[model samples]
Target: MSDHAPESGPRRRLRLRTLLLALPLAGLLLSLLLVLPLRWLAPVTSAFMIAVRLDDEAGRWPEYRWVPYEAISAQLALAVLAGEDQRFAEHHGFDTVEIERALSAADQGSKLRGASTISQQVAKNLFLWSGRSYVRKALEAWFTLLIEACWSKRRILEMHLNLAQYGPRTFGAEAAAQRFFGKPAWDLDAGEAARLAAVLPNPRLYRVEAPNATVRTRERHIRTQMRNLGGTGFLDRLSE
Candidate 1:
């Protein structure tokens, strides 16, 4: 300090500018580090699963079984796509049409419906916490973009099938199929798959074991939608 001259204002500003420029680059690199390897590596668990385990009152961890995409029933995949995000193969990450519809519904004095695509759900379930905050949303968007860029549509759907909550204290197709239908995920028929897909909006409330009126309605609707989606043939788009 005694030998060196005082830092000039321009030098301080340049340093600040350099740091500002570096921040996003650093973030991108970190994000890539987190996402790239997941292409081949199946995640042992997700952030939502961790939170579920930590918040359990009886020390009972949620059920989760990671079945490879091929091991999971193609019917289940089509069921979820029909029930949750029909445009899964078309959109890169976000479903702009659904977003616009939600925004328009809110403007018309209706409740804001979720427009999250399977890819976005994968990003949120795997990496982020559950929240409705703008900060969380911005992060979700950032991660969604990274995932779409890093992984294919099929990988994104595979992650969703393995990570989404299907019933209370149950996560993933294999776990849900075993818990509810007493069968493996690959053996789940179209009806069972649709029933599981039906409760995805709120698994805690919608009981797969005891389908209430609403759950039954959603199950029927999902089955019909699955048929309209051309059964499992609709999944051919994922391969493209």
Candidate 2:
């Protein structure tokens, strides 16, 4: 035997332990550094800026304007909750029920639907790229946990509203409100909020200014959902 040492024994165990410890420590540090700042400072840009720029020439100059959670109307907030994640306030970060539904659909060979909640959407839109890769999804979950740990539910919703895409090159509730209704987000009435929220599934295909039949049906469903969810009281309950 030539003096070659097999890579095993106590030394290997030591290295393995070090790596395991290092990973958690690094994750903790990353969470603190990134998530803490978001409590005060709004993100100037997001991963969407990267994804969009690759597609359209005009996407290079994306539209995004952040507004405080208070500035956006209650109706808009309720509409989004009703439209996107009805259990947003109830769950920590993930919705197991929705996940189960998605898994069941996959098992049945039925059309699959995204089960991402508002928090996950915020995390992805703010930090990660849009993709179907397992690595991307794992990172999205990590970011989502960081966000849930660092920010309030209200803040999460507010950020989602601001960062979420509304139309081609249009972002934020304020911008969407302006582009679609010619008014600020704060002034969006219930009907307008529902209409805007309805287009969230495919903003590019839906029109807020003149909602077609499909959008109208979705809008009606959202309104009914809002009522079924007991209105904005659900948000208050979530905070408690």
TM-scores for all predictions: 0.95, 0.87
Query: Which residues of candidate 2, in runs, are more than 4 Å off?
Result: 1-20
The models' CA-based lDDT, in order, is 0.91, 0.87
Q: Count the backbone clashes (under 3 Å) in each candidate.
A: 0, 0
- State the lDDT of candidate 2 residue by residue for 1-240, as single tens digits: 769878879889999999999999998897679778987888887888667877876547677778998889889999999999988888999999999999999999988889999999998888888769999999899989888888888889888899888888888998998888888889999899999899988887997877899999999999999999888777785551
- Candidate 1 lDDT over 144-186, as tens digits, reads 9989988888888899999999887799999999989899999
Candidate 1: misplaced stretches above 4 Å? 58-60
Number of the top-ranking candidate, with lDDT as the measure: 1
Total clashes in model 1, counting residue pairs 3 or more apart in sequence or in different chains? 0
